[model samples]
Target: RAGLRFITCHEAFASAYSDGTAVRVTTDPERTQAEFARCSAADCEGWRSLVAIYRRIAPHVLPFTNMPLPSGAAAFHALRMAAGLRGAMLDLRHVIFGSSGQLVDRFFRTDAAKGAVLPWGFHQDFGPAVKGGAAFAFVAALSAHMKGLVVAQGGADAIVSALRRLIEDGGGTIRTATQATEVLVEGGRAVGVRTSTGDVLSASRAVIANVTPPLLFGQLLPAHSVPDRVRKRAMAFRYGPGVFMVHLALSRPLAWKAGDDLHRFMYVHLNGKPDEIAGTYAQCTTGLLPSRPVIVVSQPTHADPSRAWAGCAAMRLQVRAVPAIIAGDAAGTIRGRGWADIKDAFADRIIGQLEEHAPGARDVILARHVMSPEDFERENSNLIGGDCVSGSHHLDQNYLRRPFPGWTRYRTPVERLFMIGASTWPGGGVNAASGYLVAQDLLGQASKKAPQRGIER
Candidate 1:
């Protein structure tokens, strides 16, 4: 155990959702449904049905989130999953093939409830109408309900600290500020890595890379060592829409019109109606900055009061589905040439939108920091265009075909070389399943290859 502290978020019950209107939700399905019923009675029944189905299929579906695909366990799990979906077989098919918009349309009757569900899909960095995006959204809902918006106490750095401690305890050295330039190969097998400083680090067994497909194939591994097909596919990996984040150090907590109860929750999704999100995604894909962007408001201080200064709060507004490159502004207002030139204006625009829900939200701001898509890419090259998810989770790019069609096993063409991280199977988020599965594979192989020895006297 890492001795890490956690807050289950049950005490912080309300999760706010707004699309011109507001709905307060909690982990409790019945209570959450009741909140929506105030707006539309039909939406209540639909949510009841959705929750019932979720309860039935969650046992089968939740396992896949952390489990490694392309393994024998996965095949067995699939069989169990099929049995689990016995009555809901047709619905399962629709979930897999249909869009998130369609799924919401099938269940929710009111725009209020639909808006709440639509943004869950946007977290996958795709339009709500994109096929296979519904599954991602539904799985996310299931995960949230199951886990109750879990947060590591003292912030995300606590996770890093725990991992660092674990690695060091295991006699593993961590080199920060060191960039690995190439994965060294000898006799068609990966030996280690050459750092940016040209220092060669040797590995006894394997060299695992936590990098995007493009970086792994195009930059790290020698072109001659990789198969032509694999290399080309990796090179052609598509990233989704970029993210624009704004951090606000508030003199006081946000006063939401939705209710003071909402201040308890960490996250609040804003402007997330189906049509609105669809239009925003279309605008971003066409190289135009969205005039009305979907925003995820995070008030981590609510969940963990220690995260902020005394009597003050820290908030993060993540503007969803933004263009990686500025071609034009959909609003035809801002005429900036680049994201750097427009990010401040964009932050103001976003803050103005926030003010609508939380009256005079701007007045409480102690300070603000904005990270444009360009800034995100500069901070982490893996973000390639600020796609925090590393790569797209489109049907063609996820599941068995993740990273590459035949490379989903994490083992690459080069022996003793493995790939992990957001670019691999589970496809992003902070679950760490990719690394865990790869470690299992390597340990399994090592155990199998261990030579048998006779008992000594």
Candidate 2:
């Protein structure tokens, strides 16, 4: 970078991946128009607040839609005109709190029992944006949980050390890197793992899985090992959208139009509504760009000073629900451009969007970084499709049903192998709730095994 230098990381390490993307769409177009008309007048003041927000946060989200009007009556009338012109207006608040009945509708198809739907408001994780400089907003959720907890960090060594401590506390012993190549089966009991490294770890009691259902039953374990019902359930499992990220280094501090201080709301761009986001997803399936891609940006230098040049700030832009490969086999050949050029294009687009809000923002940057899905996969094997959250946060694939039913625990189909990645419960994030949960299970299992009561199985 021309202006940035880092003391810790050779090149300051910064990553951006879509943590959240919300949409606004109406199944019935006419009704959508009617709602807008009514909202314009009664919520005129709120309307101004919304547009001002978009303009101030431009390049992130533009407040008002097509027929921009200064007054309530005008907004009400303009909404209809814009709709006819294919311009859809949205309220950012609605994305987080509004019930997309559509999302609820999708729950119906999730293969749960009839009438089984994701209980609303239960899908949120407090840690999504905290690492990106949102500690002030999320600190409450931690203390709010009355039952206190402790955490230890150090990565691979830390995980093993924590496990050993739990074991000394009378927890369980772990099999490290056995790679559960297969789940050995004889009489229907899970048995154990046949690791790629040629080690077989067998289970006399229960075998827990550290991987997702796809990896567990499909790859590690043979088809016969899974019961018919369980197999079908696993097959029916669905995943949410993946992510795209862009990292940037600038010669100057990122200045937002709204306020100099970074606001806690994670930045999002909704130039197009739900349809546009879906179109992007569809294109991703066929390897094409969607109608329009959504991006989320954050000014990390705004929070951690160590990320950029002495006076300059660093920023990250992200796209979610996008195809990892777009526009002519995006993989293998990056549209024939080097990574730098590709990243600059993305940054340029973001800056163009910024012009609406902070005009002339593009000139401030000095360096850039961009990562595709392949890039993400290369960096962190845990992030499938570059989605930092592991699996999509869908209802069934979340919480108890995650990675597949009946295997939320960290123990695997093998005896001592365990998973401590984001694929497990309390899914994803640096919080490591899944790891903590696994540790709890291990502690309990070890306590039960310690006395060695004969024939307990």
> Model 1 — which ten-residue stretch has the worst lDDT?
11-20
Best by lDDT, which number? 1
Candidate 1 segments exceeding 4 Å error: 1-3, 11-21, 453-457
lDDT of 1 by residue, 375-401 (tens): 999999899999999888888898888
Global lDDT of each candidate: 0.83, 0.44
Residue 150's lDDT within candidate 2 is 24
Show where candidate 2 strays beyond 4 Å. Answer: 1-209, 222-224, 262-288, 325-348, 355-358, 405-424, 451-457
lDDT computed for candidate 1: 0.83
Can you write out model 2's per-residue Cα lDDT over 1-457, one digit (the tens) per residue? 2122222111111111122212111223333223233423433333233334333333222222211123363466546445543323343333322343333232222211100111111122111211111121112111211111122221124555654676666756666554557877776566666878888777775565545555665676677655677666655655444566767677876555543432222232433233333344455556554334545555544334555568876666666645454444323323532333454454455556554544446777676677766677777554555566667654446545566666555544444556555566555555655565556667877898797657667
Deviation of model 2 at 253, angstroms: 1.6
